[model samples]
Target: MVAENSTPHLHSAVEPRQTFRRALDMAARAAMPSLFVMFCAILLSAPFGIPGQAQLQFGIAMCTVWFWAYSRPRSMPALAVFLCGLVVEIFSFGPPGTVLLSLLVIYGVAHHWRYGLSRLGFIAGWLIFSIFAVLASFFQWALVCLHAVALLSPAPGLFQAALTIGIYPSLTALFVWGRRTFANPDQA
Candidate 1:
């Protein structure tokens, strides 16, 4: 009788541990996308001596937002997207709200097309993202020009868009690996 009673207590103790572990896993999965984007934003902001570093960072940030928003809208909610954009804007020396607005627009488009993008091939997704990169670059350039009250050269913006489109496949592969490794297997 004592053995039977002790068995129940042991099982109960293990149950709570399992429950806690499951909850922790779910929370980590839920937070991963936003956390990853913020990490990228901070990491890319580091002062590398490469030419066009700011443009490269901004392009990478855009790619991060697009991937998360399209692939896992639930994980990367609008509020998190806003916060990520704010982080990017704070890190970069661009005009206020430029990166934020661009990211928000990207998030909106990605979220809206999430299902379609998910069903489409990688090439189709890349083409769509390329269009977004160009539009975001143009939008940011327009905002900067308006802020400065003078027309700025469009060269940097064009370069940023091209760089972003060029790096999509590589960043996407990293994101896919992260999703497979860290996210719930069923979810991935």
Candidate 2:
């Protein structure tokens, strides 16, 4: 009788620990993408002294957002995306709402087409991302112009779009590795 009573108490104790562990795991999994993107934003925003550093930073950040939003929308909800964009905007020191609006647009579009993009080949996905990059660049350019109340050259935006499209493959590979290594296999 004592053994049976102790067994129930032991089981109950272990059960709560397991439940707590699972909850912690789930929360970590959910926050990983947002944390990863924010880290990238901070790292990329560093003063590299490169000729087109801002554009390069923006390109990589956009790619990071696109990969997470397209591949695992649940991991990167809209609010998380907004926060990431805000971080990028603050770090990049661009006009307020430029990067934020562009990233939100990318997230919304990628989330909308995620199922189809998942079904397609990597090349097809790249092609679609190219379109998104250009569109986002244009959108950002328009926003900046509106903010300035004067027309601005489109060259920077175009170059940023090209850089973003060019860098997609490398960033996507890193993201895939991260997802495979850290994310739950069932979720992947």
How far off is residue 173 in model 2, in Å? 0.8
Q: On residues 113-186, what C-alpha lDDT tens digit does candidate 2 reach at each position?
A: 99998999999989988998898889888888998999999998899898999988998888898787775433
* TM-score result, candidate 2: 0.79
User: TM per model?
Assistant: 0.82, 0.79
Candidate 1 residue lDDT tens string, 1-188: 78766655544554444466677777788778767767777776787677877887678778888998888777788998898888888888887888888889889999998999999999999999999899989988998899889999999999989999998999899888877778643342
lDDT for model 2, please. 0.81
Q: Which residue pairs show backbone clashes in model 2?
A: none
Which residue pairs show collisions in model 1?
none
Q: Where does candidate 1 stray beyond 4 Å?
A: 1-18, 185-188
Candidate 2 stretches with Cα past 4 Å from truth are 1-22, 148-150, 185-188
